[model samples]
Target: MTDAVLHPDSVRARKADVPVVLGADGAPVDWVKVFLGFGGMVVGQFMAMLDIQIVASSLTQIQSGIGATADEISWVQTIYLLAEVVVMPLTAYLTKMWGTRNFYVVAVIGFIITSVAVGLSSSVAMMIVFRALQGLFAGAMIPPVFATAMTVFPPERRITANVIVGLIVTLSSTIGPTLGGHLTDLLSWRWLFFINIPVGLLVIFLVGRYANFDKGDPSLSKGVDWWGLGLMTAFLLSMQFVLEEGNDEGWFDDGMILWLTVTAVLTGIAFIWRQLVYWQPIVSLAPFRDRNFSLGIVMTFVTGLSLFGGTFLMPIFLGQVRGFSSAEVGNTMLVSGLTMFLSAPIAGRIVRMMDLRISMILGFALAAWAIQLGARVTDEWGFWEFFTLQVARGLGTMVAMIAAQQMSVASLPVTMMKDASGLINLIRNVGGAIGLALLTTILSHQTAVHYMDIATAASTANAASTGLMDGLTQVMGARGAADPEGMAAKAMSAMIRREASVLSFGDAFAALALGCWVAMALAFFTRPVKVDTGRPQGGGH
Candidate 1:
């Protein structure tokens, strides 16, 4: 294999005398195997993501079914996300402690078990606990899913693998709500949990059958960073508390939020210090030394805001504001999911040939454009506009996401690959949670401001919009048709409320546009690397 590097026109570089293999640089790889492996991991990933939103969609029904309050029902989702975020960093260690194979197997099984438990549960508490448990073990599914595809395929073939991976991840995130809603509406809400059973079992069976590979135990072999794990978990938990409950508690006004804020800060500082100073960190921080890895985190974080935030907004806006059924919300999001599936592989293909920086730049450009499209929401807008925007977002997501994901790992040492992937993805998950909470709160605030603004404007009684009292009378009549006088008063109030909703939704859409502007900075952080191939110009395969 003694070969000299020679530039080539077909690709960036060509191997001198390496064995000519299929999709190995210039050779094609075992794409069928790679896609099968990638697809299996994606199934696992989609199931995990589906769980997060499925709970939210089912909560109202579950709440009534189980006799729970709004606060109590929130736990269905909160528990899953909390477990998912908490388990994310831990999964890296588990992968090393066990092996990627054993880890994924265990993860898939645990997910299936929990999914079933959640479905068969007798009470909400039991379901929450099982859901949390599902979140915990299933956390191992994501990063490893990507790593499996990368490992199975050669460099040239990496594009194909990522396209599949990207499609799965994109669909899981974008279409989760739609899928959740469908399962909830047509079937019992419990079907959401039950659905994962068959899919997860299939994934597990496939991995056992085809995706077999070692998940090296670096912790036992490498020694567990016990102290680091505990500290990081504490830090994440504290931060989550602040973000999840801050608005409810009036920000700093609540003692619990204040305490959690302080704990998060202190624990976070300690965690970082231990990582930098310790010779053997719990989760190694060296991969982050790669500028690409750091940039990847930034990109994933900002991108998460748009991805998760939009997904959260649509259902709530459609259902809470427009009074659409759960199924309708699902149908709306299905467009985004399908579009992402279509766009990912294409983005993956071109990304391999393009400069890392160039691909990332283009990806962000698409993402920014998508956000601009979403910023024009109106109460009266039809499904087509929503579908168009979601598809654009989906397209932008694949380009930016896969580009960011691949570039981050390309330069890392093979040994740190799995852990590094986990860390970068951990940042993305945390970012998604934070994004959801932040945007929801922002949407809430903006809606209020817009509502009041519109209400104030209407008080004087314009030709187009009557006074608030008058609008209320008309809406009350519509809402409460039993008593004429009472209905008139209620109708008047409801008209004002509908006007408030329109203004609020518009304001929320505009507010989210600002976050996309911040995410555009991710393009700047990416380093430009010239493309390289595994060959010399005239070398034989």
Candidate 2:
């Protein structure tokens, strides 16, 4: 190829040396290697996701084991997220330099090594350091898996592959907490990290045997965009620190938080400038120009919000509001996992047969309804009460995720697949972070406001309040408890707090439902994508 066509940043170009495989029907066939390659990739991806979920459930146990305070232990998760998001957008460039197979092999091996180090860690600081390293490699493994699915098969088979990817993604998150709780309860918390060893080894061997993607493009590395790298890293790291710390540190009220916020904004601007102007930008921003890709990314953000936000809120509601154990909280999510397992293949078929717009609209609509229903939750809710909600979440999640993936990259050229994959996945992760932050803030602020409102109303000499107090006093008297008046007041106060907490949860779910509706509206803007009949390679899919 000529220099102009050979430019790695030439979004219109594809290397001539790459091979394309087609089936007897004159469509690109799903390579047998894809099954082995993507399957193994899924395993590694599962480990990464499982690690996050496992730690979330076992946070208290881990904190006690490492002799860390509650505040300090939060960094174990914060640092991992920081590292993961920072590396996700850099995958395409890194793969070009190291070659896809070589890069993936190294990442898998590094992940295994770090998992062991994390398991053996003796101090909070040591665990954080190792976890950050693990997150780096783990994050690197994810984009490639998605990119592989997009390229491995024709548009016809791509939906199936995407569904499989969605299945593992949803399943890992659903099962993580329950499994982690069991491991920590029956064995040591260190076993959570140890569990990755055998799986990681298996993944490494499978990837080595079956990976057939691009080896590498040496020319792409000739002009490294160091300026772009610096600005991007600055933006991601500063923003992560701010997001994770802003709520606890009082947001912009703290001087350090304020300064970092400004720094993140400036770096963010500079990074955008570099990507638009620099010839060989580390991240390709070209995908956003396509209408379908851009709109689909919006839907992806909503999907992330629901997935991560629901996961974050459920445990807090169950564990704190209902006074359930970690194991019980995890058990409540099993319904979601089971539903996803059964629903994803059906979703894949729906995407294959129905119009893309209809598929996405249906998916987002179900998700919105599910989240809205979750708003009806009360303090008295048990596992059965959440059944329909979990079922809706699972079905909605599978449908939305599969349709969103297809819609996002459907119109992009093959050469842009790698960058587009990385960008789409990055947006999803950022969405999750933003969603979790918003939900947590809502819960805190709303709980305090509701408590104050109830307290104020209680202070007024209302007849209903008087009746409640009298009833409580009578119950205490009937039980022959000491200090009936004091016990009645305490009981009333606890009741007020519980009601306030449930109200806060309801508010959070309502907000999530509104977000889903907005995503569904955006789905209409995506340009229609037509599957090519010719035996084309990655681009047309």
Candidate 3:
């Protein structure tokens, strides 16, 4: 169904009167055209995100194939994320000039090229370059998809439209991790990229054939606030670089770290100012003037942190702590992906029938609570425990994520929604960056603090320590001598690691809990826009 905004005149018109596409008499939109156009979008988006996680599940296999160090291998994820975030703000401008129809098609083409290139890459450098390119276009494509939907959709069904979009997006989300993981296990890692070729080609054909909407003026997109985009990019890229390298470089003492910190701060400030004052601003800040929109933006930002942060952490836990293979970690997410896929439509239906705010509050609360449950997990935790957590996340995210997205956007003018939605995505990108950095740093710090305490305990130095000495004595006796001191030290080493694990997981849990509160607060403060029920008009700002 096209988005049906309720307006004064439209209140009297049946749902069929709403125009979703162009007509001489302003006839109702063709829902079939919209669904087909949108379906292509979902396919492309799903393909992109799927490639990312699929590669994740097969990292070990790729490492062996390409012969790169762990440091270099990190580029696979980092470069892709960087590329995607870098181009996000530009998407609004691009679509404005080019029309979403043209913009999305081109973006998909770029992504497809990179996907194919990645499959053909013979070296690490080539892979990184192509991956970055793919990310750039993929980044540009998402906002316009929604914008087109909003622009063409009728107002009354705005929330419902978002729910449908969300359901499709969720499907993409799950498909990436699930299919990618399964493919990685069944085939080699390179197949992950190779797999995109056929699907991408099909999308290209469909988009060309069906999404033939007229291209608007190109100048709108081309006159991007490059200054703004540049600064924002540098700030994000630098900050991410620092976070990724801080541990290895020994934190602030490193000269590179100091320079990056300075650059990032400067660029971030410039970016904010550009948004506030620049004429023909690359990004529009107008949507943020509304309290509901602003609050919703905050929720979206915080939720991004939780979403991406959890996406990063879960695989690490499965692979590093539990000794599961990369394939296993990916497969685990796949299971949760299935649950998410199933729950999305259900979530959409509920939102259509119920107050979205209630569903969102509950959803965010539940997701936060579930992540907290993960804190208590030991290395001994079975697959079932984590599976349960994923199911909870699947359901909660369905509620909070969709509710937040719809409420925040429903009030914006259709023309301006591309920019608004793009900006929201950008915020989420930054939030994900901050979340990942902060979570990793906190985990490391807490683990170190715990490790040091246990390692330096007086009991270890003293032979009289009860359990410590007893365990030591037995090991020594087995070695044919009572070397109590050495045995005590070894025992401390073993026990301290477990303590560190507990502390690290606890920190992650705490972070997720805080994120939930932020999302809830955003939802609470949002004021719903009053729709005119008598006639259909742009409910847009």
The better-scoring model by lDDT among 1 and 2 is: 2
Question: What is the descending TM-score order?
Answer: 2, 3, 1
Candidates ranked, most accurate by lDDT first = 2, 3, 1
* lDDT (tens digit, per residue) of candidate 3 on 1-541: 2223212233224545554343333455455766676677767766765666667656776777778778888898888888777778777777667766677778877877788898788788888888888788778766666665555555555655676666655566555555666787788677888877788887777666656443567666555677887788898788778866776677788999999999988998888898898878877888887676788888887777877787777777777678887557757777666776788777766555555567668889888888878878787765787888888877787778777777777667655687887888778777877787788777788888878876677445576456656777677778776676677667767667876866687678777777887787667666655533223323222
Candidate 3 stretches with Cα past 4 Å from truth are 1-28, 168-178, 181-187, 219-224, 325-335, 456-465, 479-488, 530-541
lDDT of every predicted structure (CA atoms): 0.69, 0.83, 0.71
Who wins the TM-score comparison?
Answer: 2
- Model 2, position 349: C-alpha lDDT score: 75
What's the TM-score of every candidate structure? 0.83, 0.90, 0.87
Q: Write the per-residue lDDT of candidate 2 for residues 1-541, one digit (tens) a residue.
A: 0111111222221236233454333444234665786688888888887888888878998898899899889999998888899899999998877766788889999999999999898899999999999999988988988887776555555677788788878888877877898898899899999988899989998887777555577888789999898898889989888877888888888999899989999999999998999988999999999988989998998999988887788878888999987568767877777898888888877777776788888988998898898798899886888888878877887788888888898878877888998998888888898898889889989999999999899979999999999999999999998889899999999999999999999999999999989989998777777753223322223
Q: List, residue by residue over 232-281, the lDDT tens digit for candidate 1.
A: 98998888767777887787888888888999999899999988887767
Clashes of 1: 35
TM-score computed on alpha carbons, candidate 1: 0.83
List candidate 1 stretches off by more than 4 Å: 1-39, 173-191, 218-223, 458-497, 531-541
